[model samples]
Structure formats: structure tokens, C-alpha cells
Target: MTKLALSDEILMKIDKPARYIGNELNSVVKEKDTVDIRFVMCFPDVYEIGMSHLGIQILYDMLNKREDVWCERVYSPWPDLHAILKEENIPLFSLESQQPVKDADFLGITIQYEMCYTNILQILDLSQIPIEAADRTENDPILIGGGPCTYNPEPIAEFFDLFYMGEGEISYDALLDLYKKMKQEGASRKDFLHEAAKIPGIYVPSLYEVSYKEDGTIAGFEPVYEDVPRTVTKQIVTDMTQAVYPEKPIVPFIKATQDRVVLEIQRGCIRGCRFCQAGMVYRPTREKDVERLKNLRTRC
Candidate 1:
């Protein structure tokens, strides 16, 4: 049997042991040695809240489709479990193998809300990884921030190495391929980031220098390297049918916040609302085809 990061005693004491013990139906597991890249998708909140997110699931499915890659899930442990982990000095681990998140090649944390910023720090601390990007070494997993809050990531910009702006379905494959190539060639972290910045929609915070006026107003953002672009554009999927959809979502042993089959019928609301950012950010609403959606339903 595999040794779990969380002991039996800890599991028994926790409210939901299922949150730590993965192996749910449809959860992909591969031999670590066979995988070229290990990516951990994190939600800086409890498992219930993270599991309910449809965006994470979509990315999870898309990433796992590559034979060379293995994607796992992790979430912020509840306070009761958090205390035990800290007290025992155990590193933060993924649900699938109970392996340390720091060991993964990429630690992608979805930032849905601004409130979870502190929780992101908590995750980094638990993982035994540096909280700030500058403090991290090549041994550390490249910290990536994504989701809605990335529209304006300057507030928590120092913490992350890169931010994936707009929809994830666009640039992840290119990003992962680049990482794999660079890792094989023994490329330095700086070298990788410089190249990664070239990919459309990938924002490498380190490559850009931000300035502020005395009045705390914006001055201008300039690129540190000549090769790096001054502005990073947002990526979006033009056709919904071409995009990959999760056939089966991982089922939790315990009741999740929303433990039901989720179908993303449409993206980018048609209503041009001035107040809401959702309609503005996710523009030119695209939807999945009726027959394709119907076919997807049968697979589940």
C-alpha cells in the first residue's frame, strides 16, 4: 500500500477523510516515472469549494489528455487538518498520490476571488515552497496564477512567476510543451520564463518592470528583456466544439458542495452589461453544439 501523507489518526480526526484520500472514479493516476510533466491544480479554499468549480475540471481534463502529462488536484486543508500538517511538519500534498505539491513541475492555483489571496500564501507555506516568486529557486515548482482575478494581478503579482490571462483552454498545451522541452535541455528558470513570456496570454511578471508615481498612480510598465513583450494579450477559444470537455468528473467519497454532473452549456454572456466584468471579459459568447453536448452526456 502507498504511504499517505496524512496518517490514519489524522484522517479519523478530520471531518472528511475523503478529501485527502483521492482515488475517486474517473480520477486519473499514472506511473510518475512515465510522465514528463506533473501539474497540480489547486484551489486556495477547502475541497468542497474547489471541487464545485467547473473551470478547474475543464483544465484538468484538457491537460490529462496529453500522454506525457499527469494532472492532480489539491485544495487548502481545513483548519483542523491544517494544524496537524503544520505541527507534524508535513509538506502540502496532492490528493491523487499524496505527494508533495512542491515536487510537481507546475503549481497552478486558480484565483477566483480576491478573498483567497491569504489562503494562497497558506498553501505555499504548507507546500514548503517560497511564498514570494523572487525567493524561489529552480528546485521550486513554477507558481502560476489564473482565473478571473488575473484580469488585474498586480496586487498579488509578486507571489507568482506567471499568470495565465483569460481562458485556460488556449495556451496550456504550448506552455507545457515549452516547459518539457526546456527542462530536458537543462534550461535555467530565467531562460524558461523569457521564452514562456513569448507565448500569447502568458504574463511573466518578472520580465516586466512596473512603476508608480508619488501620488500612487500608474506610471508605466516596461519589459526587462528586449525579447519579452510589453503587453501580454488574453487568450480565448474561438470554437467551443473544438475544445476538450471532461467526460467524467472525479467523484468524492464525501458529499461535495455541488456533487452532480456539470455541463458548461455556454461561455461569455451575450448581455453587454456595463457593471459586470463577466460579460465584458468573456466577450463574443460561444456555446457547445446541441448534438455534441448530447453526445457528451451519454459518455458521463
Candidate 2:
């Protein structure tokens, strides 16, 4: 049995103790010694809200499919447990192994909305990581931000080590393989980040220098190194039918905001409403095959 980070006493005091426990059905758990990478996926909100997200579920299943990677999950503690952790000096832990998120190799946060911005800092602080990316040491988990908010990540760029632009399914495998190779070679964090910037869709904020005009408008933004690309293109999956989707999503103990199984039928939109950012960012709408979706529905 895995030892939970929180005590029985602490669990009893919290409203939904099951939120912190790790034995949810279909949740992935692997031996620490078996995997080269330990990635913690975070939603930066309460468990109920975080558990409802389809993107996180897909990534969790996708990453765990790799034998070299042991992907776990974490979510922002609710007010009651948040205060308890602060008072007791308990570190924020992942759901699968109930291990400190700080110990993971990567802490990938899904930045779905602007409202959850502050919660990102809370997650870092509770995990015992430096809130500022520059202040962090090599020992700290690599802070990665993804999701829709990353389209305009300038405001929160300083908080994250790197941002994964567009769909994760495209570039994540390459990124993880690079990290694994670099880790085996004993590459420094700085060296790894510099090389990681070269990967398509990866934006390492520290490598670029931004200058402001006298009127506070953007004057210039360019990479410090000549080798780095001037533009980081967004990655997209051309064929959604072959893309990985979670066949068996973990069922939360409590009722989540979206409790039913979710199936992503399509990406982008043909209508292309001007007001909608998703429709604009996710261009050239691609949809899954009807036959595949039917097969997936039966499996679910």
C-alpha cells in the first residue's frame, strides 16, 4: 500500500477526503524505479473542477502509456485543506502515489482560464517550489504551462519555465524523449532548456529578451541566441482519428462538475466566430472518424 502524504487525522477534517486519496479506479500507478520520468499533471483548481477536464484525462492516459513515463495528477487544495497544509507545513502531493509534486521531474499545469492564474502560484508554493521560474534551482521540477491561455502567455510567462503551445499530443513524445536522453547524459537544467527550446511548439521564456517602448507598447522581442528560432509555431494534430483518447478515465469519488464520460468528437470550428479564441487558435478543424468514435463509445 502507498503511504498517503496526509495523515488520517487531516483526511477526516477535510470535506472530501477522497480527493486526496490515490486509489481511484483506472488511475495509473507505477514503480518509481521503473520510470525515467515522473511527470505530475496539475489543473490548479479544486479536485472536482480539475477532474472534469478532458484534456488532462487524455494526457494522463497518453503519457502513462509510455513505459518510461509515470504520469500522476495533482490539483489545488480547497480552502479547508489549503489552510491545514499551510498551518502544518505539508507539501502538496500527487494523487496516484501521494508523493510530493516537488519531487517529480516535471509539473505540467493546464492553464484553461485567466481566473485560475493565482491558483497556479498557490500550487507552486504548496509544492515547495519557487513561484518565479528564475528563482528555481535544478532540483525544482520543471514548470510547464499548457492549454488555451498559453496563446497569450506573456502575462504569466515569468512563472513557468516553458509553455507548450497548441495541442500536446503532437510534441510531448519528442519532448519527453529528449528529456530522458538528456537526463541519462547528466545534462544541466540550463543546457536541457536551451536544447528544449529548439523543439517545435516549445516556448522557453528565459531564452528570449523582451523590450518595451517608451509608451509601454512592445518594442522588441527576440531570442538572445542566434540559433533559436524567431517564431515558435503552434502544433496541431492533422488526423484526430489516430490521436490518443482516454478510453477509461478515472472516476472521481465525489460528483465532479462534469461527471459523465467525455468524448472529443472534433477540434477547431468551421463557423470561426470572431469572439471565440478557441475557434481561432484551433484552426483548420479536424474531426475523429465516426467509426473510431463508435468503437470508443462502446469501450467506455
Best TM-score among the predictions, by candidate number: 2
Q: Give the Cα-based TM-score of candidate 1 against the true structure.
A: 0.97
Give each model's whole-structure lDDT: 0.91, 0.94
Q: What's the CA error at residue 110 for candidate 2, in Å? A: 0.7
TM-score for candidate 2, residues paired by index: 0.98
TM-score of each: 0.97, 0.98
- RMSD for all candidates, in order, please: 1.2, 1.0
lDDT tens readout by residue for model 1, 171-269? 999999999999999999989998999999999888998998998766989999898888889998999987888988887777889989987788899
Which residue pairs collide in model 1, if any?
none
The lDDT, on a scale of 0 to 1, for candidate 2 is 0.94
Among all candidates shown, the one with the greatest lDDT: 2
What total of clashing residue pairs does each candidate reach?
0, 0
